[model samples]
Target: MIDLRSDTVTRPSAEMRRVMFEAPVGDDVWGDDPSVTHLEHYLAERTGKAAALFLPSGTQSNLVALLSHCQRGDEYLVDQQAHTYRLEGGGAAVLGGIQPQPLDGLNTGELPLAKLKAAIKPVDPHFARTRLLTLENTFHGQVLDADHVAQTTALAREQGLATHLDGARIGNAAAASGSSLEALCAPFDTVSICCSKGLGAPMGSVLVGPEAFIATATRWRKVVGGGLRQVGSMAAACEYALDHHLPQLIQDHEKAERLAAGLAAIDGITVTAQATNMVFVAFEDSAFAPEPLHAWLAEQGILVGALYAPRFVTHRDVSMADIDQVVAAFRDYFQRLTR
Candidate 1:
């Protein structure tokens, strides 16, 4: 099936699998895995961070970063709709006792600087001390303005709070915004980038930050069962994705745009949003049941998520031909309504 559910459904290319098979292996928890070490160093240099840690997932990377930055009872400011806050299973609060101070972010995934100022709790025993300000680079496929990041982090510093970025789709943001990863990450104290998503790796995420902070996250990683033995295979796949598949995300974004345009022309379809490699769309027909579309699309060898506004994701596995097929399927579904 042509899966448009998420980029996370991506499989490593054959070339990536070859590298994974050939990668040198050692226990990562002991800091002896050469492949893992190489991957970490590569990402650190790319993002201009002093150190990096390879984790099993972006969720683990973000959680470890949170544990490293905030102590028990400390709060981190985040967007109400951000993955680090609303998603990721609340690992920060569950594992680190870190509280989240969620504020509504702008359409560009930026919190108003004034709202941030108002949200900061006065220094007192009664309030959860704000310790970090976390941001997502691509909030629901919309790239956050890089200028907004610099300004927000600068304000976060003035408030004596550290900053972290849940950059799970940072590569997508980089491609869409035409900004270097270093420029996007420069203002944040820590940043996590996932290779398992749009980058087409089997599984892995790299969390980059200062050496001291990474050291703290290291302990938390082990505590939370992220320390892996012989993890070079996964690390190698992620590294290969960085070298190969990262550039192709721009193509995925183009496909999403193509899909969006086609969906917009349909009489009963509402195109809510489109950015990077994701498209949000809804059926305008009052009698339109998403389940029927789901079943119909499945019959057409297409797969999508069951969201209120169905979200479509483009990835390496989806070709221009496949995108055309999806558009055709949707057109067929709607055209049947006329008859």
Candidate 2:
């Protein structure tokens, strides 16, 4: 099937598999994994953080960061649409005993400062103590600029709150915004970046922060059962992706724009603003619901994502040819509907 579901669906390339097979690994929990340590150091240097810890997944990385930053009964603020709150299965609340204060995320992927300020809890006994402000960059494929991130982090600092960034797709954000990864991560105290998503790694995420914070997060990672043995193979894949795949994301963005323009031309389709590699397409009429559209596409040997509204993503494996086939399918389906 020609999968346009998500960048996460892309399999590891041959180079990545080769590196993984040849990777030197040791017991990570014992702090003897040279390859894992190298991956952590590389990620820390890339983000300009003092230290880094490798985690099993982006969700675990974010959860461990939240657990490390906020105490039990503390509150953390994030956008209502953030993946941490919506997609991470309430790990913060369930495991960390923290409350999530959901705020509106601007179209640019930054939370409104005034709204964020109002969301903070006063030092009274009546409310849950607001301890941290979390932000997500490249939220749903839109890159939030550094100026906005700096402003929001400054706001959090003034309120005596720490900051964490859920930067799962931060590489895409940095590439799209023409910003250095270090510059993008400068404001937040900690950042969790994914390697398995658009970065094209098979598994793993790196959590970057001060040495002290990462030290504590490392302990929390173990408590959450995220400690892995011989994970250097996975780390090797991430290192390879960081070195090789990151540079190709811009091409994916270009392809997404090309696909979006073609979909926008269809008579019964509406493509939302395009940014990075995600495209949100809404059918003009409810007569063609996403379920039927998804099934029809499957019959045509295509795989599209089933989201709240129909969603399609461009990734490493999806080429211009794949985009053309998808567009042709859209045209054929619409023509048949009009008959």
Instruction: Give the number of the best model, judged by lDDT.
Output: 1
Q: Write the per-residue lDDT of candidate 1 for residues 1-339, one digit (tens) a residue.
A: 999999999987888889999999999888999999999999999999999999999999999999999999999999998998888898998988989999987867899999998999998999999889999988999988777788899999998999999999999988887888888889899999999989998888999999999999999999999999999999999989988888778999999999999999998999999999999987887777788878899999999998566899999899999999999999999899788
Please list all clashing residue pairs in model 1, or write none if there are none: none
Listing every candidate in turn, what is its Cα RMSD in Å to the true structure after a full C-alpha superposition?
0.9, 1.1
Please provide, for model 2 over 1-339, each residue's C-alpha lDDT reduced to its tens digit, 9 standing for 90 to 100. Answer: 789888999899998999999999999999989899999999899899999999999999999999999999899998999989999999999998899999977766688888999999888988889999988888888888777888889998988999999999988987798888899899999999999888899899999999999999999999999999998999999999988998889988998999999999999999977889989877778665676777888998899777456678888988899899999998998899899
lDDT of 2 at 83: 89
TM-score of each: 0.98, 0.98
Which residue pairs overlap in candidate 2's backbone? none
lDDT of each: 0.91, 0.90
Reference-based TM-score, model 1: 0.98
